[model samples]
Target: MPVLETPPLVHETVVSDRREPFSDIVIIGLYAPKIAREARPGQFVMAVTPSGERVATALGIYEAAGDRISLMLVVVGPRTRELALLERGDRLVLAGPLGNGFQLQALGKNVALIAGGVGLASLLLPAQRLLADGARVHLYYGARTAGALVDAELFEAAGAGVSLATDDGSRGHHGYVTELLAREGRTHETIAACGPSPMLRAVGTLARTLGVRAQVSLEETFACGVGACWGCVVPLERSSAQAPAFPPVAPGETRDYVHARICKEGPVFWSDELRW
Candidate 1:
C-alpha cells in the first residue's frame, strides 16, 4: 500500500552514446539497473530531451548492453523532432524502468508475439527471455516497409519462427499483421504484443473473446513515471472480481491503471486487464 519509491530519478554517473535511424541521439547512459536486471518484457523509459523541459519522449529499449542500451524512435512529436536534431554527445534525462513488466512464467512454448510498427521496441527483451527459456516464439511483426523491419532476424536467429507484414506489401505478408493474426495466432498458447492502442485493443479484444492468455504493452500519454498524477492511467477490465476497476470514479485500490508508465507498471498488462 505504501507508494513504491520510483528508484529516485538520478543522473547516472555516466551516460553512454547511442546511434539509431535518425538521431545520432547520445545514449545518455542507463538507469534503474535493478529494474533493468529484472525488467520484464514490455517496459519502457520516459525521457526528456535537455533542449526544452516540455520535450519528453517515451522510448522502448530494444537491446540492453549492461550499462548501455538501444532504442528505436521516430520523429513524431515536437520533443522527438527536436530530439531528432540531437548529435551523439547530447545529454538526456530519464526516469525509470517504470511500469509493471511482463511475466514469462505465465507464458508457454506456443507463444505468439505480435507487434505493430516501432512498438516492437518493447517486445525485444521479453522475446529474448522467452526464447532463452526454450519457449516456442512465433513473431508476427508488421511495419510500413522493409526499412522498418527490426529484430525479425534476431527473433529468427533465436530459433523462433518469424513472419513479417507490411502495409505496402514491400515485405513478408502483404497485409496487416492483425489480419494474419486473426487467422494464425489461434494455434499459439499465449499472445504478447505492443504497438498503437487501437491495434493493441483489437488484439486484446480478440484474445479475451477467445480465452487466449494475452498480454499487451500500452502506449499511453504519461507525465510522471511514478503515478503521482492521473496522467498515465489506462482503462482495463477486471482481471478478477477482487481486481480493482480502472478509471476509478474515486481514489482507492479499486482502480487498476494499466500501462500507467509504459515504463513502471507496464508497458505490459494482461489482455483482460485492459479496457477495450
Candidate 2:
C-alpha cells in the first residue's frame, strides 16, 4: 500500500452535483481538488453532516479526477439521510483520503475485482489503475436487482470485462456473485473484493478454495474515521504487514493475532491474514 505523503486535513467543499441512481443510493460530487489529488484506491473520507448535529459519516472515495471527487452512499439512517438531502452548491466538510488502500502491484497482472451492492464504490479506482498499468481486469458484480447494479458500464468503458449477478435473477447470473466467480474457477492471478461481511467472507473462502490470494476491503461503522476511538477493530494475523505495532505479548497472551483498527491500518487486508 502507498502512503499519502501529506496527512489528512479538513477540506470545506461545495457539492458540484448530486444524483440518485436508485431510491436511496446517492452519488454526490464535490469540488475538492486537494482530495481528488491525494485520494488512493480503497481509501475513504469522513464527511460532517450538513446540519452538524450528527457525527461524521464515513464514505468511500468513488471517483477522483481533476478538481473533483464523488462519494457513493446509501441513505441508511439520519446522518446519511441528511447528507442525501444536500443540493448543488451545498457546503460540506471532509477529512479524507484516509485508511490504507489496496496493494495493487502485489495483485499482479491479472485481477478479478469483486463488488457487492454499494461496495462497488471502493473498487472503480482500482479497476482504472489496473487497466492503465496494462493488467487484465475482470469485474464480478452483484446486487439485489438489475436496477441496483449501477455504474458497471463505467468499468466496461474503462476496458474491463464485466460479469454481473443479481439475487432476484433480474440480470446476469441468478445467484451470488461469488458463485459466478467459483463456477469460472481460477482464471486470474489474484482477487480484490469489497462488500458486506458475508459477501466478503464468501470471497475469502472461494479464494482459498481456488488456490488464489485475495484482498478484502471491510465495511464497518466508524465512530471516529481516524484511529482515535478504536471502535472498528478486526482480528488480523500478527504477521500481516498491515498489522499495527504493539508491545510484546505477555506469556499468557495470545500471540496468534492482534486487533487492528479498520479505520487506520485497514479497511483493506489480505484475506488469508484476517482471523475473523
Candidate 3:
C-alpha cells in the first residue's frame, strides 16, 4: 500500500477546561476546536504542558464536538498531575488526532464495546459514533470499584445499553467485565475494546471463541507519540496499510509480520491480525 501524507499537527488553545474526579482517575475536558474537528473515535493526542516541563504523554481524545475535546486520564504520575491541575481558561498544547482509530462504520449493526478502567476514554467516541449510525450498542464496562466505573450514563444517553462489573464486587457483576461480555455479548456482530493488555487479551479470546470480529485498542507507555521511537510496538500477523514494507521471507508468503508501531500504525488492531 502507498503511504499517505500525515496531517499537520496543530496547537489548539484550551478554550475551556475542568477536572471530573471519579475514584482516583480524572477526566479533563479541553476545548480545542481543530482537534475536535479532526479527531476520530479511538485516536489520541500528545498533550504537552504549557511550561514544557516534561515529555508529552499520549491521551485518548475522549469526546469531541463543535470546538471542544475531552481527555480522560488517571493521575498516576507527575505528568498526569500537571494536566489534572489545569482549570478553565488554561491552555493545553495538543499535537494531533494521531494513530488509527476504530473503524466503526464497518462494524455492522450490532456491536459490543468493552472498557476497563481508564480505557473507557478510548471507547466513548466509538460508542457515540456507532449509536449515531443507528447501531445497537452494548457497553460492557469494568473498573476496580463501583465508583471507578465512571460516566456510564454518558453511554446510556447515547442510546447504548450499559452493563457493569468491578473487582471489589461493588457493582453489577462480581468479577471481571470480560465475563459479562462473554455471557451476554454473544449476540453482537462485533466487539470493540480498549483497556489494559490482559483485559484486551481476554476480550480477544472471547471474540474468537464466539466467532465474532473484534478490534482491540492496546494500552502502551509511549516514549514518543510519533512512530520514530519504535518504543510502543505490538506483534501483528499481517501487514496493514499503516505498517512499513518488509521483504518477503518465503515463496508463497510475505514476511510473517513485523512489530508495528502502535503510536503510528495503530493503537487499535483486528483481533485476528494480532500475534499477541
Candidate 4:
C-alpha cells in the first residue's frame, strides 16, 4: 500500500461527464487532475454537496486517469439523490484522494479480485496495476440481477478474465460469486475483495479454506472521511501493522485487539487480521 504523503485538500472540480449505466446508478466524471494524479486504487473522496446543506458524502474513486477521475454512486438516500442529479459542467467540491489503498506488490503474481454490486468501483485500478505488472488477474463479480452487473466489460477490456454471478440466475452463475470462486478452486496466490459485509465475510472464510491470505476492503459509513470520529471502527488484532497505536491497556483490561478506524487504517485490511 502507498503511504498518504499529503493531507487531503479541497479541490474545485467540474463535472465533465455523467452516465447512468443502470437505473439509480450514476457515474459522474470530474476534471480533477490533482486528485486523479494522487489517488490510488481503493481510496475514496468526500464529495461536498453543491447545496452545502448536508454532510459531505464519501464515495470510492471509480476511475482515475490523466486529468479526470470519476465517482460511482447508488442513489439510495437524500444525500446521494442530491449528488446523482449533478449535470455535466456542474461544479462539485471534493476532498480526497483519501484513505490507504490495496497493497498491490504483496498480493503476488496471480490474484483473484472479487466484487459485489458497486464494490466493483474499488477493484478496477488494482486490476489495471496487476495486469500491467504481468500478473494474471481474474474478476469474480456479483450483483442482484444481470442488468445490475454494470461494467464487467470494462474489466474484460482491461485484460482481466471476468466471471460474473447474479442472484436471479440471469447471468453467469445462479448462486453467489464466491461459490463460483470456490468451484473454480484455488489458482491464485492471494485474493483482494470488496463488497457487502456478508460477501466480504464469505470471502474471508473462503480464503481461509483455500489456504490463502485475503485482503478485504470493509464497507462502512464514514461520517468523517478523515477518521477523526470513531464512528467507523472495526475490531483488529493489535499486532496487525494497520492497528492504531494508543496508550497501553489499563491494568484490569486484557483485550488483545484495538478499534481501528476503517477510514484511516483501512478501508482495506487483511482478512486474517480482523477480529470482527
Q: All candidates' lDDT scores? A: 0.68, 0.94, 0.86, 0.93
**Against the true structure, what is each candidate's TM-score?**
0.81, 0.95, 0.92, 0.95
Clash tally, candidates in order: 13, 0, 0, 0
lDDT of 3 by residue, 1-276 (tens): 235565568686673767666745877777788889989999999988666888888999889999889899888888988888887888888889899899887788999999999999999999999889999999999999988888999999999999999999998899999998778647899999999999999988999899998999988988778898999998776556555665566688644787888898899888888887
Candidate 3, clashing residue pairs?
none
Estimate the overall C-alpha local distance difference test score of candidate 1. 0.68
lDDT accuracy of residue 196 in candidate 2:
96
Candidate 1 lDDT, 1-276, residue by residue in tens: 355663464443224444554232222334335435644566666677766667367777666646556556766777766655555555656655566667788887778888898788778788888988888888889888866776577778768788889989988888878777777537889898888888887887778666797888787777666566656656655453323334545655654443233434455777676555
State in Å the error of residue 106, model 2: 0.6
- Candidate 4 stretches with Cα past 4 Å from truth are 1-8, 251-254
Question: How far out, in Å, is residue 94 in model 3?
Answer: 0.7
The reply for model 3, stretches above 4 Å from the true place, is 1-7, 239-243, 249-255
Stretches of candidate 1 above 4 Å error?
A: 1-7, 13-17, 21-38, 238-264
For 95-210, candidate 2 gives per-residue lDDT tens digits of 98899999999999999999999999999999999999999999999999998999999999999999999999999999999999899999999999999999999999999999
